[model samples]
Target: MNIDLRVIGEAFHQFLINIGLTSGQASLIDWIFGALILLVIFIVLAILLIWFERKLAGRVQDRLGPNRVGPFGLIQPIADTLKLFTKEDITPAGADRITFNLAPTLAVFSIVMAFAVIPFADKVIGTDINVGVVYLMAFASVSSMSLLMAGWASNNKYALLGGFRVVAQLMSYEIPMAFAMLLPVLLAGTMRMNGLVEAQGQFFGLGWNIWIMPAAFIIYLTTALAEGERAPFDLLEAESEIVAGYNIEYSGLKFAWFYLAFFMNTWVLSAVATTLFLGGWQGPFVSQVPALGVVYFLGKTIIMFVIFAWIRATFPRLRIDQMMSFCWKVLVPMVLVLFLLTAIILKLGLPTIAVWLLILLSNVAVFVIALWLLGKGLEKSKWASKRLFTPEIPRL
Candidate 1:
């Protein structure tokens, strides 16, 4: 018998066929059902990720995280949800009532829409389009506007400042992120996400984009941290400077939405990195046991998230000048050079293995040189003295 690897969309269509539905009708139903499933899955995953981050942070700090709540404090997120629900939704006195309210909704909507093109497992995807990569990048850009709305509508100086910071910060990093993503598309010759993963299946466990394009992977991950506004790059809510930043005036469920969207974007970006660079759901025996594709995919996602949280725990927030400098001066040049190298290598018309090996070696060289340049720059930087004083501050 032929192997059965069809995902929910195909399986549902087959079921509808047996039940006498027309092909168009079955396809439409499949789409509707798949969309609902994805929405519900991310919503629940977002809840659990909140608790996961807390527990991980607790461990990193030598403490038990939320042991008093449901098993391993899994129910803590639900309880927190209940608490937020019971609190009054307070709008600031001078805030634009309409934009203030709509901002949170738009923030979450932008991220949730990106999931529509993500391929969770073999044959399991929300939608496949020729330009799936472009679609994801476009949708991800929309959330920046929501942050601006939240900041401007609040009428708070700090909030407005934070909004301006977001516009500068997010826009600066997007260029490098897009350039880093370009290598994978050039290699696969397809913007389709599933095709990206399938291209790496030939070598099983070893055939991964990260293996060949390590420089792009590094650039992508570093830029992703900035893009998602997670630690070091989390200037949007740099507590000491702005006291909660753009969402300072928001409270109750509205505030909850802002925070939740923050984490969900982190979650989504991690998943995207795994799909685009790592082997995604491909693994040894994955083809024979198709369900294992979901397992491998999720496992990679969790590993990626752990690295994200670890960075949050370890790094200090950067100053505005330093943040902008790193993007425009450091990351942008790095991705540009990597992109040019990829093009030149492809133009040489080398054999497949030779091309991958050359790219891998070139990536390793770039990473080492970038580190050397950073160290030299830091020694000459005026902020060196300030960083030396950072150790005097107490930690919780």
Candidate 2:
């Protein structure tokens, strides 16, 4: 049988016509394909992050991490997934069974939903919503609600305390986080992730947003870590104090969901950090190539992930009081000052000298103020302890 190329091409065209797909509809098909690709990327990234975290933690603690599972432990996450799936699910006696079952899923769901608004690259965004940043913040708050549900449903006092601590900590940091985020939005003039990335690209020849607005960058990094509930700010799950915190009672697949959510949350935060401060997806000599922006985006996200891991490995967890005080007393003030300085710079159209001078002054002032506050807090703590320990005459 002779194969006619023109006949085959005509048959394919007829098939497209049969399915109500014009060339324009083909574009929609391409978009859907792009989205599926992004979903795959997300899954791969999540698994990679888990493996990276384990290896990093192992190295830090002087142990081999997951070396037995697959070559170089590359398949450890897959093994862990199979194990969690086959394990028996347990609901504690006297637990609110419905919410108990739903809580972990909700936590995972909220994080995945937040990813919808994030732009992975110029053309690879899932949904380019105008209120993308706000959407992210909203879903992040939902994580707190999930923790609350998990805690309350378990009927455990420790879980409740952990839930309360998480909610309180998230609330305290959210204000400063929002304010710090505003500086970037002010500079970028839009809340969309693509717009933010584009704004960064516009200034690519100058520098990354981190260097242009160092104070805001610092505030953003600190607030992001706090919001992410990473180490130092991760009192929500302080195992030594609260015995696994809000997820103490969860097990099997449910527990796995919570764990997956934590990984996903960190991944999204890294992506957001990459988008906002780094020249997201805008690399030197890369954007010139068509469709290579995703490479740059992934690179930035991975770098941010490494930074997150480094901080987690390096810093000791902050106490609850210290966490709250640091966010409100230190970060909020610094963010507020940064916002003001950014506003003035924008309005006055100042030269580089003026901008650098303002940044220097702001940093110096913040350092001095933080030092003074720490000194006062220490003195108060000592005096209060002294009075509490003082021998009292029998006033009774």
Candidate 3:
């Protein structure tokens, strides 16, 4: 039995060699295959996200979401796709035809480009580019420009307002978001997503980055939701006020493209969170099995999506002023402080327990400061509103 097992192992080794693959070469081939698989997975996930959002929104409002299409509305996305394809394409009479036509395409393109930089798992990355993190941030920003173009070219007031809101909200959130992202980069000591995953893999026991850096994780989650324009930060598409927002003038497949881009954007944001704070695809004993890393990565992404959904269900949208204040005054400063604390801990060569304690203390300090500031702001706002609105009367 031992001799037969040895022979089988030898044959497998020879087979690998015959394919022009050293162990490293075989691994590269596997990575390429995994990327292609992920591409398909992303496409399917986009469709499912549409169904999920609809079902979730329905539940929030106490209604059934698309039950007649298929089993539990499983085929609703298919029906929607077909309807979009067959609908009449309408371009407004005075709209800038070229820019209007190009906007949706740009939106979809930018999102897919951003996905190329995300490392799904340790060995399942698309490319190990030196500037992967920067590349992701850049491409993500391009989607905002697409929104700008779509709104501007449509020549609609509501679209213009929606685009402007997107610019302001996204720009404000990016500062804190970048700082939050920096936490993972500092911990991993690399910009490459694959490198980040590898660093997390070196943890001894229960050593995921999430536990090591809960503040960063919390900040990352909040920023990601804002970046994706999900609830509590979805003021850009305030339905009652904006009348369908930037895509108001869009119809047919053009409208579909906008919705598709939104779904893709959300998925990519969740994937980024999974790759950064959740250790990408690192799981105990899973690396021993070939290709299981990719499995873990997808599972992690799904969990992130569920969290996103949960937040959408629970939170109401913030007012515009409140949203701006929250991002600029609250999240950005907190993330900067966290970054400083993390740097100091790393510099001092502190033990893991010490590092965690420092992080906890920092969080406590931030919480106290924030509460104090909020109370002050509320009192001042009440006084200012009364003064401003209660002007001096001629008779009284």
TM-score for all predictions? Answer: 0.94, 0.85, 0.84
Clash counts for all predictions = 0, 0, 0
State each model's CA lDDT, in order.
Answer: 0.88, 0.79, 0.80
Q: Give lDDT tens digits, candidate 2, residues 268-339.
A: 888888888887778766555524677788888888888888898889988777777778777887778777
Tens-digit lDDT track for model 3 on 213-313? 77777878888888888898898889988987789899999998988888788888888888887778788665565356667888888788878877887
Count steric clashes of candidate 2: 0
Q: Tell me the lDDT of model 1 at 27.
A: 84
Candidate 1, residue 366: Cα displacement in angstroms equals 1.8
Which regions of candidate 1 deviate over 4 angstroms?
1-8, 14-23, 385-396
- For candidate 2, the 10 contiguous residues with the lowest summed lDDT are 1-10
**Model 1 lDDT per residue over 105-195, tens place:** 9998998898888788887788778898888789877899999999999999999999889878999999999988888999889999899
Give the candidate number with the greatest TM-score: 1
Using lDDT as the measure, the top candidate is 1
Off by over 4 Å in 2: 1-18, 21-36, 203-205, 351-396
lDDT of 2 at 110: 91
